[model samples]
Target chain A: MTTKDIGPKNPVEQGVTQVVDFVDERSGVKNSGRWLMFRNIPAGTSWFQTLGFTAMALFGMQAITGIILAMYYKPDPNTAFGSIAHITNEVTWGWMVRGMHKWGASVMIVIVFLHMGRVFIWGAYKYPRELTWVTGAMLLLMTMFMGLTGYLLVWDQKAYWATVVAVNIFASAPILGPYIGDILRAGPEFGPDTLSRFYSIHMLLIPGGIATFIGLHLYFIIRLGISEPPWAKRALRVQRDEEDARRKAARNREAGLKGSVSFPPAWVDDEQEVKR
Target chain B: MKKADKVAYDKDYAAAKKDGKPFFPYAIYKDTIIAGLAILVVIVLAITVRVEMGEPVNPASTDFLPRPDWYFYFAFELLKIFANQNALTPVIMATFMVPNILIILLVIWPFIDRGPERRIWKRPFAMGTAVLVISGLCYLTFLGASTPEGIAKGETLPLTGLDAAASAGEAVYLANGCSSCHMIKGVGAPGPGPELTNEGAKGWDNAKMVQWMKVPVAPMPSFASLPPEDLENLSTFLNGLGTKYK
Candidate 1:
């Protein structure tokens, strides 16, 4: 309304506005974007709340680094190790990318865990946000699985034996264990195909799952709103005032004024507003 | 939470939001700063602690340490604790049971603790679990990090007996990287495998030892791939440890 008279000062500005309006008219994405950016969050949202975003940012970083690495990397068991060596030794700036990818995996795991711990400590998982927490739990597990599958991509002696043992552990799990192991190994044994299987899983399968779960997680977070710090001064003050009012109402009733009193004044007002 | 509790929470949150600010700038700024710092740290680590190329995978050469990445150290350390595989601490406890239980607990924790309380001090159970889990993971990771590798280069076990058969067995053990998991005579990594300093005390025949090697415990890979003679020699070396060779 304020900008009605000032709409698009120049031809270029007018064109830009027209383009945006055209898209907005059809998709309504502009409104949703605006809502997403301008949504009111509790003022006491702590620094710890940044962990989720940081984890997502790390995931983005991983995707970028992974794409670059995948360009020069081979997924075959025989060539996988040699390709890694080529990347590290011959390719220009390849070592840095490999290092970043390697280091990124470790850092991402740390960030993800810290995020989970923050959620756990804040008790932010309660109530309507429970499903958000569940989605987040899925993300955490996927992140760990990402690490597992990614580790095997290097195809080094350590990685190979370690994965063999890890797969063996999975195969040992009772019932579905062998099947899971077979699927992971691409057979009952670790062969040439195991590398490609893990590569697909590390790069495609788990990342897709993570991205999808992250979408669900963010949707929940935005819809339900970020939780206020439970011990925020303002929140505690509100709680205290409510308790005081309830006590006063109780005291008044106990004083034999129950018939005359229009008690629980604020809460009664809230209830009436709800009914209306 | 009950209906009333949920209603109160919504009302309280609405009031908080009414008094709050938009997510942009306020929250975004913090997120950018922390994430940028994290990225910076990762870049620095990449530069300072460059990743190294290791030996190419040779599945036939079971003479490898089989160490996973640092993040997996807690699980690695857990396997060690339950390595002995007695009834009191089955190997499954580490490989399957404990991890599954912890993961299940993590996923369903929100449902389990469906209370209105949020303050850390007020939620003693949650707080206690947090402390215990955090400390336990840190401790296990530390143990994993500090534990000696399977075997140092050129390290030798201190033993007295050296018959040709036992010597061949010891060679098979060392050649196959058994030290990566088991320690013997104060040598080798103290591991996800039992120490074999007095392995002969078990009195297992070489036949039994060879059979176990062919299909060992869950976490241990089968050595059935080894030549029968090598397996027989390893069994002899392992079986005659404390009883005759000490």
Candidate 2:
């Protein structure tokens, strides 16, 4: 509201602001920027709700390290194991990147499972959040598969046999057993093709699926605001939300426009001010 | 917020202000610290430990055992237990039935437990089942980790003759390194390939032995690269272990 709030004249701050403003302009964050950064959570929201965000952060870590690992890895029987050795011993910081990737995966799984536990315990998946739960389940499957496929990329003796056992497990799917095994192993038994197949899936297909599901999951979370903590007065929260929706519909009707999409608090307030 | 929604949220917001902190520096600040700590942990591990990569793949020799990464020990142990129970027990049950069923249960769990309560005691059935599953997995995984691999064990066929391989077959047999796994009696390290001590006794003539060499079962690195002459000599050497089945 005043020049003083804009900021003091400092070149460094100005440069940073310029870059940020450029990005914000391109991103169209404008009003929604506030929605993302400072949206109203239930007064009862706590650190417990941040588990999902933490899982996402860990996933980003996995993706970064995974991409780097893919660079020097050769998905062939002859060199796959050896290349990993080279990365560990020969490439500088490669071991750290790899170890982080390995540990990150285990940690990511732990965090994701914990996030699910939090969601379940909170009963946050009830009522309107069913699709959020479904998308999350899909994400969970993709994450586990990513872990499985990534295991095969190491090409060591253990990697080979473990994958063989996993492929056999796929073969146990009644009628689809042999066919699934063929697809996974790329043949009747493990060979060169199996490594490449697992590599592509680990690096691309599964990550793609995960990314898509994450988008849907977050979209649902934002559209239907994060569920209130179960300990919060559920009836009161629901009643308030329904009443808000009813009033919003009435205002929309007065403006001769049907209700389109639900608006968060700011836009709703703006509409109300216009109505007044 | 519409008038009613704004009133409700504002009331909560003002009440929350008494104790609640802004999410930005508070939530993201906590996230940054944790993320940095996590990265530090990863870096420490990366620097301190090197993942053990075992010897080159020797499909023919069963000397090297294959195990999975630690996370899969539950499934690995399940298979091991099943195999111990009945060698006839299909691996599929452990591989598909157990894990997939657990996953399906996880996916559908929310729908099944749609109730108004969130207290742990109120959800006794769900909480008990979860604890049981987690404890079982931990126990099984520990067992799996400690267990060894030998379910599909193989034995190397012993043979003899330090200097010669059934006449002129010596060079070809050693050239392709067939002797490493298929040894003359008391000649090489113990291996997992079938004992050729008296492979000739199995009754396949020279031709049959060579044909079999082209493609072998899994975990046996294929010998598809052996030259034709090499194949013939190895076959000769294998067959000439020279003993009667009786």
Candidate 3:
């Protein structure tokens, strides 16, 4: 509600307003929240535009599930496998949590790709939103690294060897390869330290980077405002009207000085235009 | 975009926003619905397709297939295309060049295509690139997924013409789990490694094969720790694949 409604309210509403006002005076958080929530967005913002938010929701899901898994997971080599087994077979609702985490990784990947595809196809990355695309690209790469590092956390035979080959591929890069490999493995070879290292990188480092980039990405999106669909009727009409006006101006110039070279008036009122 | 185009875009966006609805209910409803549906899909998948526990890791064992998750399948498949370590299709293309090029391209795409026209049909180059890249990735991922895992334990290579040394080499291959990567007469996994059914066609000596085994390319672990005699025998067996052992 607007500030004018503050004068008339029930006891509960009055108490809530008092608390909100207290915080608002100190931090101006209430005003900022209102600004964020009540901002005007293009009416043509389509369903496809929602993919980014969906991808973010999945990331939140992953974070919650990952926390639960971390509670029971032991990152040490000797105990890692056993801990996974215990989580899957013994802990209450642990299997469900682990399943959600695993499946969530895959689902997140799908959503992220779809989001990128939507952005690409719509050309939403153009103009003032270039940095938004850059931040989004960072998030995509981080999501992929999240998958790579998280794969090995299971400590299964498949994950272990896949990671070995992956690191080897990194190490195979010219000049910088070997160093990257060593850092990833925490030594020259996979050992006790490798598992914990991956666990830390997966849970801490990449997630932190992703969160930071997400912040930047959201800032850009809000600042730039939502991109309008190119095929929207209003956009097409605008293009047509501009073209017509340009052509008319050229004709009037060709006809020689006709008074002040007049142009058509602005768009009609919303109701009248809709009635047509 | 040009300076004029940028100015026009800002003006148009401002006008659009002025005539638009508030973010509180209009856009939020769509975002919530789609995101909620996505979470529901994840939950349903987790419930129906329960995750299975694979065999525990054993560092000493080379019998395992080093398969990545499905999303990385395209990259894994790329390794196979350039697995030969030859001049034409160097392994570096897969391991270093292509992936890095792709990432760089991805990050800087906005700069690459700065045109103000957002209509899909108007941008042939961008549309073509999108189709090519997306389809290429999908095809590679499909290939990676369809490729079989290494032959099951106790399954032997379907080959002929084994001499005593070659037989000894086959024994070495079977014992060391080379089948996990390579196929001989269509008996092993199709990828992450090249097929070795006609490996002898290369016409290398036993010595060259032995050397390669010790210092192989990335993604292929070294076999230097194997005994000298075993390496020699394996090299002899491999060097005569299509010519002698086929």
The candidate that wins on TM-score is 1
What DockQ does each prediction reach against the true complex? 0.66, 0.18, 0.63
- Least accurate stretch of 10 residues (summed lDDT) in model 3 chain A? A266-275
Cα lDDT computed for each candidate against the true fold: 0.88, 0.67, 0.87
Worst 10 residues of 2 chain B by lDDT: B148-157
- Show model 1 residue runs off by greater than 4 Å: A1-15, A236-276
**Per-residue alpha-carbon lDDT of candidate 1 for residues B1-246, written as tens digits (9 for 90 to 100):** 866667767877787888899999799999999999999988999899999999898888898987888888999999999887678998899999999999999999998999877878879999999999999999999999999887776777788867999999988999889999998877888879888888999999989999999888778898888999999999999999987787
What lDDT tens digits, residue by residue, belong to model 1 across residues A1-276?
Answer: 364576967999999999999999999998899888988888888999999999999999999999999999999977898999999999998999999989999999999999989889988999779999999999988998898999989988899889988899899999999899899989977878889999999998999999999999989998899987777755432354466577777888899776566555444445543332
Model 3 misplaced regions, further than 4 Å:
A1-17, A236-242, A245-276, B201-211, B224-232
Model 3 residue B69 distance off true place after TM-score fit, in angstroms:
0.6
The candidate, 2 or 3, that scores higher on TM-score is 3
Question: Interface RMSD values for the candidates, listed in order?
Answer: 2.1, 6.4, 3.0
For residues B37-139, write the lDDT of model 3, one tens digit per residue: 9989888988888788899988766667888999999999898888766789988999999999999999999999998888888889999999999999999
Question: What ordering of candidates by DockQ runs from best to worst?
Answer: 1, 3, 2
CAPRI-style grade of the A/B interface in model 2: incorrect
> Any residue pairs clashing in model 3, and if so which?
A171-A177
